[model samples]
Target: MAASVQGGRIGNLPAEANAFVGRRLELAEIAGLLGAERLVTLTGPGGVGKSRLALRAAHAARAGFPGGAWLVELSELRDPDLLTNTVAQATRLTEQTLRPLLQAVCEHLSGAPVLLVLDTCEHVLDECARIAQELLASVPELRILATSRQPLGVPGEHLLTVAPLPLGERDDAVALFTARAAAAVPSFALTDANRAHVAAVCARLDGIPLALELAAVRLRGFSLHRLLEGLDSRFDLLVSPARPRLARHQTLRTAIGWSHELCTPLERLLWARLSVFTGGWDVEAAEFVCHGGPLDAEEILALLASLTEKSIVTRDDEGAAVRYRMLDTVRSFGAEWLTGLGEAEAVRSRHRDYFRWIARQGEAEWLGPGQRMWAERLTAEHANLRLAIEECMTAREPETALELTGTLWFFWFACGFAEEGRTYLERALRRARAGGGPEHTLAVWAHRLVTVVADDLEAAESVSAAYVWLAEERRLPVPALPLTGASLAVRGESARSAVLYGSVRQAPAGDGGAEFFQLLTLAVQAYLLAGQAAFERCAAVAERLRAECAKRGELWMGAWGDFFVSLAGIGLGHPDEAVLPAREALAAKWRVHDRIGAAAVTDLLVVAQASRGEEELAARLLGISRRLWHAAGLPQLGRPDLSVFHREYERRLRAALGDACFTEAVRKGRELGPDAALALALGDTADAPGP
Candidate 1:
């Protein structure tokens, strides 16, 4: 599923794993500010719970903003240039156009009331401020809740300084400590025997949620009296009364340092090394990236469990897999220690190398039964992949960057990241050329294909010419011949496209070793045949492709096959027979979060419904298709052959329903949310409107 489709909301705010002990008043205030102000920043020192408060407030206010609340995490993002792209991706605005990214983001949000919580903005303050300002000015109903150490300095910004929890006998800090302590040790509780000690520990830690939680977890290894003594000594040595302003900041640092000191040497080594990951990483990634020297791969799981028990690292079981992440404050501490150990570069290199291996593996297996699995795994690793590419560019390893980008073309193309892929490919190509790096043929062709899919024909043609030259020099067959045929078909050259596509089908079995590409070739050929009025040939090819994809357990390419089969059925004057396959294709596309494919299948449904004399349904479906295309950031499929059918069927519907009824139906269809629209399109009578 798309990241935006979290439950029914278009956001990715994580569910709170533990009880929210405090922040009741702050939550109310932040909620009120969000209602009155367009932009609000929760400013405070690190580990004062800014991110947690922001998430709580956003979730509480989610209902008011129908567009859904989204969290845009900036901690893992290092390069300032990717701020906007990161926001766009987090908001799930898959802009498949050449327009400026910020412009597309604004346009996507202009029509809806969205709440965006930008977490960890201090590092990219200027960029965040600029984008926040632009988004606020351009989008009328958009609200942003930012968590930063300092203000964004944007106009109309409301600043809410988050403070640590209050410490007292029955305050939130003690309650939080008690709650966490219970989790750490089931027998622990707030009794007369230990209540005073727990309160003392919270007070000494300044009632900071993170610090208190860290202290509570120490109950697993230390007695209450011993934990209190350890904190007393650590605080006295670390905090100077002369620097009151930095006292809480220093105290939190001291707490984190104390935790570090308590770790075994191997655990400390692993902690520092795991800081190299961006976003959350699974156990497998942790093992591959952090295992070396004193840290053995087999010891990683136990080490991870220990850290989780210590509350230094958190585990998330909400996704398809279990993943772990350090809070930004904790991660920063680990990063500093890693640097202090003089192992930052080596660990980061290993991080990049692991992801590079992952990319190659994903590319090799993407055509098989693991297609969906690879897509989800790679999507989960999106941030790490970007970091790896960024590191390559920073280290002036453009050849590595080029090859990595090339290897991930399937991910970018089939997984709804074509625009992002184009951005990386263009950057890598430019850098490689400037640095005089060898031009990898795969990278060159990958760039051409992504560019074409993103509707940048001019840029794609330029890169295609380069690839053609390179192919001749190397005396090898072009691997992108199917892409060339696709471009030709898009430009109304059906005859030439057919011949090129036929040549690809006739190539040797081991020619490309890319079953995905072969399936795509067949789908494209089916579309071409349909456009040429050869219904039988189109049906046959589409069915064959669909059977192949089904046997391989692939849904993306198979959905395309379903679409073509429906299209050919309608062309063969069997509208009734097209309905089932059209509905099936639409559902499958939506399942894979293929907005573009969903829109295409919805268009086919419109034609199918219209041919069956369901003019009203067709008009409504046309509206839904328009909305889907708008969401996909495209006018249509960008295929002239497909466009011809849509235009013809739409004209017929307009005449049959008349302008007024057609317009009203379309309006209603456009108003439906994703779930409701899909339900209605799938013939769920409950969601169907009255005539």
Candidate 2:
């Protein structure tokens, strides 16, 4: 159910499977399972090359199911709860599923000719089977190729019992091992001297692919006689002549055990501790989280790097960060090793604290607009952030957990992650309320207020009590508490909003909340709503800042100020005065590349241009504005409270245009309000009817 930062693992279908070396008969056998039967279960003992065979056939036949072929690997999954998510991911379904995910799977797959390759289903047989049967029944065009130890038993499932690679003369297994061993260690060839022994070993092992490969690894070091001396005891011996019927089937566990026994002690320790990380870790993270008695951070990093070379960890192709993760088989082996070492919990806690410190550093960088880029860096480590929150709370380190979520507010909002933001904020607030440190409450109130104001007035007021609590506390960061005033204003409590802003103890005029952005927003609201006189006084201070923006060519923010100024001008009925400011808003929008704001400002410009008798341009610009707004996904009217703006447009259009054309324009603008739409469509109302 959780999202992973670990680079995803994709198992390759054997190369010969693609070339389909000597398996034309086998391919036809599997192909028959797909026709008339929606489910084909591939049952085989471990290392019998089941996955390679099934996946290859599915890949070859992918053209028939134009919908696509998807592989859902069940090996890495530790929790059965994750079954649906894994399937969802494999099918490339991005939307959330509330009903059982299996039902969602059917709905998504229904009538879509798709072949799903369900690999390694033995561990989660029941969940996999339930999904397979539902898919087979509901999806007319869906088929499955499942690899498991046992049959799914779902109706219409044709069992294709996969055998190991053929072992006698002209067999694929002996040839593959000989080729791979020669490639892995060049000087030591699989000549006639070792050929006889290798073939005998393959027969004894029932030609299991995994066992053959492991045995091939020893050809460089051990003579055939020496290897045979240790053969029966080693998993590769596979010489169980008396018990050919064992269900153990000379399995994955034996093959993995032989690999684990070869690792040095330090390497083994590193492997075990690395499992404490929920996702793969970067070198620095591995150093700190897995540090131990003899292994310092440097040694841990080196060990991780070394493990990658040995295939214990897979290195990622993405270069933003060099990271490593264990393969499913190796991870299982490492987990067992970790339990024996008895250090899982302590390693997990260290991992949590490492991320907490990262959050603290991130908080300092989030203070200014530079925060935007810093938030991006933090984003790359999101899984670590989530794991830190989860582990810290579970460990009762709520203080650190609260800060972790609190500091990431910028990333939560700016990155189109609002729903995710709400989730973490809720978690942080609860922890802060329970036993988190003092900053928690401030953060909780701030996060809640942002969510409320952005979503709805009902939400803003829902947490009014929290705002009142912060006001009483009056901390320096209580600027967040004062935001309740803005929320209240949105809810029609202008007077209360005024009083709260006025009540804030101001520093000297030039102090300007000493570089806090919240103070700037608060000061802007308080100054403007405090009425015309207060706005004029504050405009002088704003003028000084506007000069700095002009100097930097930061037309965007300058236009933002002009927007508020134009609104003030319109309220005062000084159309002539509003003209330059409204035009400036348009310029600012284009200057900063704010398309949404650009379209909005064009509407305002239409009203201004009409007031100034620019009818030809106003009419054409209105058409452009309408087109832009439609394209921007906001085709409706502007914010609900802009009636005065509409009236301004109507006044200009009526005065400058004739009654006949004005009447037709009025007919068209009628849907949007004859007043605003007329100003938007045909400006210049010198002889127009009164609003």
Candidate 2 lDDT by residue in tens digits, 1-691? 0111111211222233123333557789888778767888888777677777777787677767655667776665544645665676456342222235566566655544777889989888888888787777788888889999898778777888877778874577678667656655677656666777777766645667666666666655676666555554674355477854324454555655665566678888888887766446688888888887977877876677666655567676464577677654557667777888788778878888888777666545443333434444565565566667777666555666566666565445333233345566676667557643455754565466436432255555554555445444444333434445556655565666654444334322221122223334444463345343554544443454355445434344455566656645655556677767766666555433344455556676666556566664454455445434433333322234644544555566656666556445544332232123324333344533333
lDDT of 1 by residue, 149-189 (tens): 99999989999999999898799899999998998899998
What lDDT is reached at residue 620 by model 2?
43
- Residue pairs of candidate 1 with colliding backbone atoms: none
User: After superposing candidate 2, which stretches have Cα over 4 Å from the reference?
Assistant: 1-163, 186-193, 201-206, 214-230, 233-251, 358-457, 460-691
- Per-model clash counts, in order, read 0, 13
The superposed Cα distance between candidate 2 and the true structure at residue 199, in angstroms, equals 3.1
